[model samples]
Target: MSKLRNGFIVLLAVFGFAFGSLSSVSTEAQPVRTAEAATTAQQITKINSTLSAKNKAAKKWIAMRESGRSYTAKNGNCYGRYQLLRSYLHYNYTKVNQEKTANKYVAGRYGSWTKAKSFWLSHHWY
Candidate 1:
């Protein structure tokens, strides 16, 4: 009975050690994920800041009216913050691509986000 008790104690210690090592590995991984998230957020902030204040405000207004800044927002054939036609994206739907494509489309079709917003205000779409 003493030998059995010792064996059980050894088994519990082995399991405890294995679990401790696994938890430590996961804890070490957490910082890398957090750092990556912070880097991505910083990049997004930089990209957003590139616009002039007026253009940024117009863009935000349109985004709010269209999709409320949701990256995955969809309505019929439109998608993303700008409510762009899915065909316009050629299936590339990353946030960066969405921003770039929206900028180009707004520039091409309306000359600026401000103009697009005006059009939306008058006609309910842009």
Candidate 2:
């Protein structure tokens, strides 16, 4: 009788622990809506500002703007906020503006057109 009682108690304890652990465990992943939205918005803004159809001057600006703001990682060789280091300029901008470097240097960073224009106005080198 005692052996049977002991076996039952052990089984109950094991089940209780398992139940407790299962209850404490979360099954669903929580979504970070705000952060995700901000990131997505930024990407969309970047695409619209830089990647979409551009005029010849805009394309030239993206390629050649080699001012200080143009560096990508600050550690790696990323030359522009658009991350154009050497290859992009060499392939695209250099030939476009063989006479001047003005079109090559970045006049703005990753911001709205207004912000970029403001940066250009203030920095004089963006």
Candidate 3:
């Protein structure tokens, strides 16, 4: 009976320590992407030619509010500066992919970044 009690105590201690260690790891931490790993401004321009200057400003405005222009930003299942769904990115979290997908998304849903910005203004999200 004493041995059984000792084993139970040891097992409890092990699990308690493991849980404590794991709990200290923050799940909300946003990993920073190095400039070399992130998409370049030139690459963005290459793919971002469709948006007018006004629309580009609107897009940047929305990105600032959404994720502080982070390429690796995450919120629940949303990812990237635009906070698009991970599924929309098809599990590809690359910055270029995020930009492309966000562009397509805004175009399909709002027809333009300016329109999306208007929606975000009224709803605080787009």
Candidate 4:
């Protein structure tokens, strides 16, 4: 009787531990989802403000090609709409900062967003 009771207790503990781990994983995932949602909203607003009306479509096309307009997008060391190196962001992943950085990078590298889009078209990367 004692061995049976001990075995039952051990089984109960294992089940409890499994349930607890699952609950914690779910709780942690919620915050990641929320952050992703907020990043998407920020990307939309920042992209609208950063690109000139004439260049908006081209810039949008580039961003879509790079990240599908997702601010939280990542590929290896590249991140965000422009696929900037993670080091360039300096841990500041805000939309305004990303837009500013992307614009500066585009201006320096391609002279304009349209040109950048052209480059991307030929090379499949910008």
- The candidate maximizing TM-score is 1
- Candidate 3 lDDT, tens digit per residue, 25-78? 643232334444454666888789878999999999999999999988889999
- Candidate 4 lDDT for residue 24: 99
Candidate-wise lDDT, in order:
0.90, 0.46, 0.89, 0.85
| Model 2 stretches astray by more than 4 angstroms | 27-126
> Per-residue lDDT of 1-126 in model 2, one digit per residue for the tens?
999999999999999999887766632222466667677666545534543344333443533444433433232554444444555456343322221222234333433334344464577434
Task: Quote model 2's TM-score.
Answer: 0.23
Count of clashing residue pairs in every prediction: 0, 11, 0, 0
RMSD of every prediction? 2.9, 13.6, 10.4, 6.2
TM-score of each: 0.75, 0.23, 0.68, 0.60
Best of the two (1, 3) by lDDT? 1
Candidate 2: Cα lDDT at 32:
60
Could you tell me the TM-score of candidate 1?
A: 0.75
lDDT per residue as tens, model 1, 1-126: 999999999999999999999999999999999998888787767777768899999999999999988989989999998899999987788887788888889989999889999999999989
Model 2 global lDDT (CA atoms, 0 to 1) = 0.46
Scored against the true structure, residue 65 in model 1 reaches a CA lDDT of 91
- Residues 1-126 of candidate 4 have per-residue lDDT tens digits of 999999999999999999999999999999999999788777757656756775778888888999999888999998887789988888788777788788888889998888988899999998
Report the C-alpha displacement of residue 25, candidate 3, in angstroms. Answer: 36
TM-score of candidate 3 on Cα atoms, chains taken together? 0.68
